[model samples]
Target: MHIALVTETYPPEVNGVAMTNQRLVRGLLAKGHRITLIKPRHQEAPPAEHASLQVHEVFGIPIPNYAGLKLGLPRPGELERLFEADKPDIVHVATEGPLGFSSLRSARKLRIPVSSTFHTNFQDYCADYGAAFAARWMMAYLRWFHNQCALTTVPDPSLIQRLEKDGVQRLQMLGRGADTVLFSPDKRDPELRRSWGATAHSPVALYVGRVAAEKDIPLTLEAWAAARKHCPELKMVVVGDGPVRKKLERQWPEVHFAGMRYDEDLARHYASADIFIFASTSETFGNVVIEAMASGLAVITYDYAAGKQFIQSESNGHLVSLADRQSFIQCTESVIQEQSKMPPIRAAARATAINYPWSATIDRFNHLLQKAAKTEQITPQIDIVSNSEQSTL
Candidate 1:
């Protein structure tokens, strides 16, 4: 199968969508498939080195308030030429950016099957970015984009239901997985823990993700502060960088801000922590939650998406209601107060996380692409020319 995967981001970008795309592309290549990977280029990273993979770089502009990430520009003319030369069996649109929009148009014009995956909750992000009024318009555009594809893949059932309610057709459930081998309890380093002023007996609360408004990072800090009141020795470390990292670091000088750790280093940071707090409500599926769980950290998150699917409150991990912000803080404090139950909870989390492997997710993704290629395409009613010319959100 020759699969042309189009996205605005890819590996060395340190985001969930980028990492997931890399994993899927590698998995497909391993199964003896040719891949044409098209994405926005990053100066620090080179094109993927694979015999079966062909990478095409495109021009992009930096997104507002998002540092180190680019919004890929539409290249309809270039894409049409590329498709004409070596037509792909299927084109998978990962991100609904300008580049992805152009790819969809090109593939449709060439009469090729196309599929898309709903990765981010851009509609939910509107409120965080002070553009709450645009959320409805965002959803409308999203529905129009995905409805055009033969299949629209989502990470969780909750998301599938939400999109269906919003009138998105051809929806399918496709879950993300954690790398248990790389992110295991065995990766725990006592030296690293000590650097964060944590010891064997002392607890280290960890938060790993973009330190941005949408992540509800303020809630994580508030929970950590409240938790520290009961257990004065409790330490907090935030791993990952974003637009607000500098401001947050200055605001909370006591907390350790370990910026942008990747691969094995990222796993080590996860293993060194005792508790993981992910308060973000806007997620298709929180990849970090599963990774933290795989690293044997008792997680505390909202009762939805990955948390609701894998965690049993007070068993494997903790779950708070999305509507109750106060309850999240209380839950974090209570989890810290009961130190005796930590080992069992952590053990259960790791055990459950190991069950979900990347291999299974890859197999399912491949099946969806193959199935989509055989299905008839649905012509979208929206004007592709107008949409492609519009500015990227």
Candidate 2:
């Protein structure tokens, strides 16, 4: 299959979206499929040398205040000309951005199959930038943007339900995968654990991913504060960097910040931790939970989205109740006190992660693209102005 994967982020960026696309691209190339990877030029992007992967560099404007990265803006007619020059059977927009929108418009003009992935919640993300009121407007824009594509893929059934309720047409369940080989129990480094003030028996809790307000990071701090009452050595290791890093580190100097890690280095950090705590309420899929699970770590997360789908409370790890912070603390401490119960929990978690493989996931994406190309383009059946204000939760 000839596929053009358009995304705003790509390799060397080191986030869930980029990491996910990297794996999918590698897998697709291995399966004898060609992929034209389109993305903005980041300072850290790897060399584009793969024979099967064609890299198209787009003009990037700095994402204000953000160093080493930029965003691709809209240029519809230029993209249309590119599509006309070299056509692909499938045009997949992996991220929702100006570049993706332009790609969609171009693909539509060329009468090619079009598809997209719902990787993040920009509506919820606006709140982090102090534009909370703009969430509704953003949601309305997203609904219209995605509905134009023939197929839209998200990671969970819960999100699929939510998107359907929000009038998202032709929604598809496209699960993400983790790298089991690197993120195995064998990657655990006792030396590294000791360096972080963790004794062999002391409980070590972890939060890995981007450090942003929308990540619900403050809740992790709250949970850690509660955990410290019972176990002082209940160390918290935060392994990622973002605009909030300085503030978070200054606010809580005792916490260890490992900064951003990628590939095998990241896997080691996941394996070394005793318990994985994901307090985020806004995740679409929570791929880090699966990565931690694949690395054989006991997980404690809320009972929704990724957590509800994977964590079986008391069976694998505790799934904290949303309404009761005290109950959450109690359940968390109980698990930590009996931290001996964690090995089996971690094992079961790792066992569950093996079910999601990148090869199968990418193959499913290809199949969906092929199927959508044969179906009628998803234009609205009725013309009714959608209320942009009522979409926010």
Candidate 3:
């Protein structure tokens, strides 16, 4: 099947959504599906394209206060023209940005079936950014945008129930996968641990994600501080860049900040660590949790998203009650104190990650696209004339 994938983020962006989309596109191509990827052109370098994958780059602008990331401007007419020229069998909107809205409008205008994916919790993000009042407006807009599609795919059953309760229509639950080969216990580097001032015995706690307010970085820091009281030699390593990095760096000079490691390097960082710490509660799906688990690290996360979906608490990994800061810190201390039992726990975590392969996720996504293509098209209610109107948030 020929598919048109519309997204604001893509490869080289160093985000979960971009990486997942790239993997899905490659998987679909391997399955003999032609995909036309519509995304914002990178400022530095363009990504390599495949024979079956056609990449259409559009104008984009850097997101405010977020370096190394760009938001694509909507191009409904251009998208319409491109679709008219080639005419894909189905359209998959991977983001709810302007580009996604434009793609939905274009597909609707041409009477083509379209489906969407709810990857980010933008409403929750608004609360983090101190714009909590805008969450209702944003949710209303999101409902309007996604309701135009034949189906809206979510990551887990919890999210599906919440979205359905909030008036989101036609919700489908789909799980994500991790690259086990790339992220494995075998990739652990002793030399890398030495570089971070960590010995074979000293505990090294790792955090791999955006160091932003939404991630609840303060809670992670508090937990780390409390854990260090019991395990004095414990080293904390943060592996990601975000708007809050500079401020956090100044605040916690003892913690090692390894800004933005990708692919093999990222896996190495994850494997070298003894424990994985994630305190974020605003995730539709936390990809880093699975990646860290695949790398054989004893994960400590809240009981939600990937943690709730995959972790079996004391058996595989440790999970604290959602939003309970005291429980999170206590759990960390308990896990650190029982360091001797971590080997089996890490092995169990890796075994669990091995069960979730990327091929399964790709097959599920492809099946959904096929189903959407076979379904009837829904006409769009909003009128879109040019990029100017659609580009505005």
Candidate 4:
């Protein structure tokens, strides 16, 4: 099948959505599916060449407060022209940004099947960005945007329930997978640990994601600090960059800020750590959690999405009640203090993570896209009111 994949983020951008989209593209390509990629041109360097993949980089504006990310601009007419030139079997919208919206509009206008995936909880992020009042508006927009699609794919069942409550229709669960081979216990580097001022005896706590307020990074620091009191040699390393990196660096001078590490480097960082602390409460699904688990680290994350799905609390990895900062800290400290339990927990984590491979994810994704393509095109719900020969969505 030929699929037109539309997204705002892609490779070279160190984020879950970007990485996941890249993985999906690779998976689909491996399955012999032709892909037409549409994304923001955040950099001048073109994406890597692929035999079955076509690239379309569009004009984009740097997203405010999100360093290294871009908000794709709308190009409906341009997209329509491209689609008409080489029509795809289905349009898979991976984001809800302007570009994705335009892709949906153009595809629907051409009576093509279009599906979407809800990767991020954008409405939930409104409160974190001091726009609590806008959450309702954001959610309403999301409901309308997703309902227009033949089906809206979600990462977990919890998100499906939430979206359904919000009036979004035809929601399907599409779980994510981690590269167990890329992120494995064998990748653990003692030299890397030594560089972070951590010895074999010392416990290292690692956080690998955007250093932003929405991520609840402050809570990770708090947990690390509390754990440090119990284990003086405890080293905390944060391995990502974001808008608040500078401020966080100033506030937590003790942390080994490794900035951004990708591929094997990221895996090494995860393996070298003894425990993984992801305090983010705003994730639709935390990809880092599975990556850390695959790296054989005793993870401590909130009990939701990936955490709830993969973790068996006190067995494979630790799961704190959602949004309970106090429990999160206590869980971190407890996991560190019970040093003997780490090996078993890490082993169990790896065991669970390996079961979710990209092959299975890709199969499910292909099935969903096939289903979408075969289904009758969904009528777009957005009312088009024309004023002065202009149609507003």
Instruction: Quote each prediction's TM-score.
Output: 0.96, 0.93, 0.96, 0.96
Please write out the lDDT profile of model 2 over residues 1-393, one tens digit for every residue: 788989888768767888888887887788888888888977667787578888887888877655545688755487778777768777889887778878887788678878888988788888888999887778787887788788899989988998888777788998877778878888988998998999888878899988877777777877877878888889999999878888999999999999988778888889889888888777888889888888888888888777887778877777987645666667777876777787788888889888876667878876787787676665742222255434444
Q: What is the C-alpha lDDT of each candidate?
A: 0.90, 0.81, 0.89, 0.90
Which model is ahead, 1 or 4, in terms of lDDT? 1
User: Tens digits of per-residue lDDT for model 3 on 1-393?
Assistant: 999999998878888898988999999999999999999988665655688888888888899877877788855499999989989999999998888888888888898899999999998899889899888778777877878888989998899988988778988878998899999989989999999999998999999998788998878888998999999999999999899999999999999999999899999999999899999999999999999999999999999999999999999999999999899999999988889999999999999999999999989988888888998865445653224423543
List, in order, the clash count of every candidate structure: 0, 0, 0, 0
Model 4: per-residue Cα lDDT over 203-316, one tens digit each = 899999998889989999999999989999999999999889999999999999999998999989999998999999999999999999999999999999999999999999
Residue pairs with clashing backbones, model 1: none
Query: Candidate 3 has what TM-score?
Result: 0.96
- Cα displacement (angstroms), candidate 2, residue 180, comes to 0.6
Which pairs of residues clash in candidate 4, taking residues 3 or more apart in a chain or in different chains?
A: none
Candidate 4, lDDT over the whole model: 0.90
Please state the error at residue 351 of candidate 4 in Å. 0.8
Q: Tens digits of per-residue lDDT for model 1 on 246-342?
A: 9999899999999999999999999999999999999899999999999999999999999988999999999999848999999999999998999
How good is model 1 by TM-score? 0.96
